[model samples]
Target: MEDAYTHKDLAALCSVSETTIKSYRRKFPGFIPVLTRGKPIRFRKEAGEVCLKIRDCFEKGMSVNETLAELGKHFTPRTGAAPSPSPSPARSQQVVSPEYLDKFFETAGKMMQGMAALATAQAKAGQRLEKVEAVLDKLLEIEARNGERFNELLTKVGSPSPDIPPTASSSGDGAPSRETVRARKIVNVRGSEGEVRSYALEKEADKATGGLEQPPGSLLSTPIVIRNDQDEFLGVPGRLPLSGFVEILVREAEEDGASLSRWERAGEAWVFVMDLTGGGSHALYFTATTTPRGNQVALLERLDVDGKETTPQFLQEFFRQVKDKV
Candidate 1:
């Protein structure tokens, strides 16, 4: 059985605005409050609700850090798997009851509505900002005209008048606008001893040395974006396949301090290796993140060795030998 509370009561307990509560619910589908005809609404009294909120935040593109901050908690040390005693009896009394849960869902519904409302509000604000900016420009132009006329009138009347003040110090009209600048990291993985990233984009027709042509069936190079925990794009790279034995030039070294791990299958077991090039010359760490992807992909991961597994250090050396010839 559930004890129910009204929308207002739940809002007070959650320490969030009714509007905010509604927004939170909108992110997660199918959130409902238990309600009764004559009594208040009821809500679940478990941390499960909070957990779901965290998941929803992640799906909505919020980072783990953002999720923690939203729930008003700090990082706690993890404990080994073991049962712990329940909270003190007095503390349990303060926990949210089912009645409060009902209210929480109600607020959650409103929050979803509010999020929709907020999107609408943001669009409206953008329009309003543009309008205000336009109006301000017009007003400033009018002021300019009025000042000219006033000064002329004063001179004709043989009266002394003060000069009009220039535009406000706070005015942004003449100031340069700013935007976030993102640095582009490009890795030039040109095979053999050659120019940076192959000046083969066709535009450098005049300056590029074409004495060296790529051997047939060589790497058809392309780039992939490296993304951060925040989903912000960090670098563009062309990862050389170990099969091709091509050397990789890691550009923008500072941005690439973190190593990248790769997984592949060899025979029955799956193998993994990480690019530890930045760590040292011919250095790599190997581990398994999962089992092999069957014989089909395993053929691709096989090496000239026992056709078993491979480490990143071997890969770097294999490609280095290729570069040494040219």
Candidate 2:
């Protein structure tokens, strides 16, 4: 009787993991013949040689198709037992070999096991898919409810309040006065250090105005005033090309002893990475959008200091200096 080797024996011989040997058997099923199909299945002794050859081929970076071609040169692939010749009429009484019957039953059992495993996997996959779909449906329902509530709130905000009496200036024309318009109270403001406080906005405003109150009629008469406090950083002209503006900023930063590490286009924005002389880094993202006049304007969308999302005071000063040169 020919000796056969188990998966472990072959794995030890090849200096490879047992899992790797199993994978090889699965990948080149024809090359590795099973001598006995049972617990710790046994393969023909020649299978070890085939496994070593496969390992060598893999180490050489040969593709599966290339390995298959190479394997065909030295080994005869097992294509299963040839069909028995038809019994001659003169000698019709032929006894079936017990060994052949055993082999037949083992192969059939393997097939049945494979089919059972496949059915189990498919059932588990279907259950997981149903769970995912249920979660998505719930999320969509929540999103729809939130959208409806938001719209209702917007409508309430835009409409004039019936509780407040109409002023003399608005009573004759039946139009809402400026005071009648909803003023969105500042609920919270987040600072550069990520601290959130309700008084932060007022405190910052006081600091900017040196705690002085604006005299009546001295302020702008417009309903809304878009302040240009950081005009040096944000006062880019609409007519200027965004690329040219970026180049100017880069030159200014370089002249200030800061070196640009790299720059790249991220979607519709240009990202600039810079290395500061004080052993730190910063990234600035500049995005361009078309105005109603069909002119492009560049806006600084985001700033990062040393890979963290923060707006340090030094960065503000740096940009102010850059702006002077621009």
Candidate 3:
């Protein structure tokens, strides 16, 4: 006769904590046969195999929902064997043969190797596709704005004030604009090879000042502000006194349940890889400094997933918040 196992047994078989097993059970209700849900929850003998499958999917980096879906594809209910005399305790202890164990390990190894190769190929293809799309979109935008941009340049050139010489540092209105003079070039680096991400900055009318546009956080005083893909705020980014604002971001992410997978200093800037608890990961590059010029934290790219996601759309709101705080 087969022996049913308790939650503790299943946890041990799956090599996961009891709490993790409970979470999986909640996610995949009815997948496991629960004999009882009292003080010590028990499961049918067949639930052991299901637990193993769950563990495999998680180890392969599949999300909880994805794991459940994948397992559901090949799930089969257990059927009891024909009635027979119970085996001796010593005989029952010998479950798997050496040949079977060796075969299982060999197959698992091949599957993992194939999966790694496939994942690498897919990631590279996706990154290349994203870069191409970004470049095409930028070209189309520049083509569309050629007329208006040319007119603006002509206006700036034609209407220069005779009293105030039109130097490179001075704005067209004869005022020295901080944006034009203090703006720094930020390069977006991405992909496994980590090539420099480059694209044209299209002309946009500033809604706040009703004039020329500025960088994402140019008008704000805070070190950084974060927002989701839908332009919703995800709380303000961390700030430090002198330097190491990047360290503050890492600490804040840990506090918020995000795992810091990769972090490294790149020249004068920094790159961070964060794995969100909700699933998916993001690569962020930024530069923060309190220099003789001023305090500035510049985000190089709009936080994007698959090339298009949450952009830094809260610049106006950030400026408003800083003004209110002051």
Which candidate leads in lDDT?
A: 2
Per-candidate local distance difference test = 0.39, 0.60, 0.54
Clashes of each: 15, 0, 1
Can you write out model 3's per-residue Cα lDDT over 108-207, one digit (the tens) per residue? 9999999999999999999999999889668644643564454444344333233443333667788775434322222234668867664222333322
User: Which scores higher on TM-score, 2 or 3?
Assistant: 2
Query: Candidate 2, residues 35-100: lDDT per residue as tens digits?
Result: 988887999989889999999999999866667767877788887622223345444333566688
TM-score of candidate 3 relative to the true fold? 0.23
Model 1 lDDT tens row, 177-289: 22221112223345677755511111121111122222112111211122233533322223233222222323222245634433343344333333444553222222112
TM-score per candidate: 0.15, 0.25, 0.23
Evaluate residue 312 in candidate 2 and report its C-alpha lDDT on the 0 to 100 scale.
45
Q: Which residue pairs show backbone clashes in model 2?
A: none
Candidate 1 vs candidate 2, TM-score winner:
2
> What is the model-wide C-alpha lDDT for candidate 2?
0.60
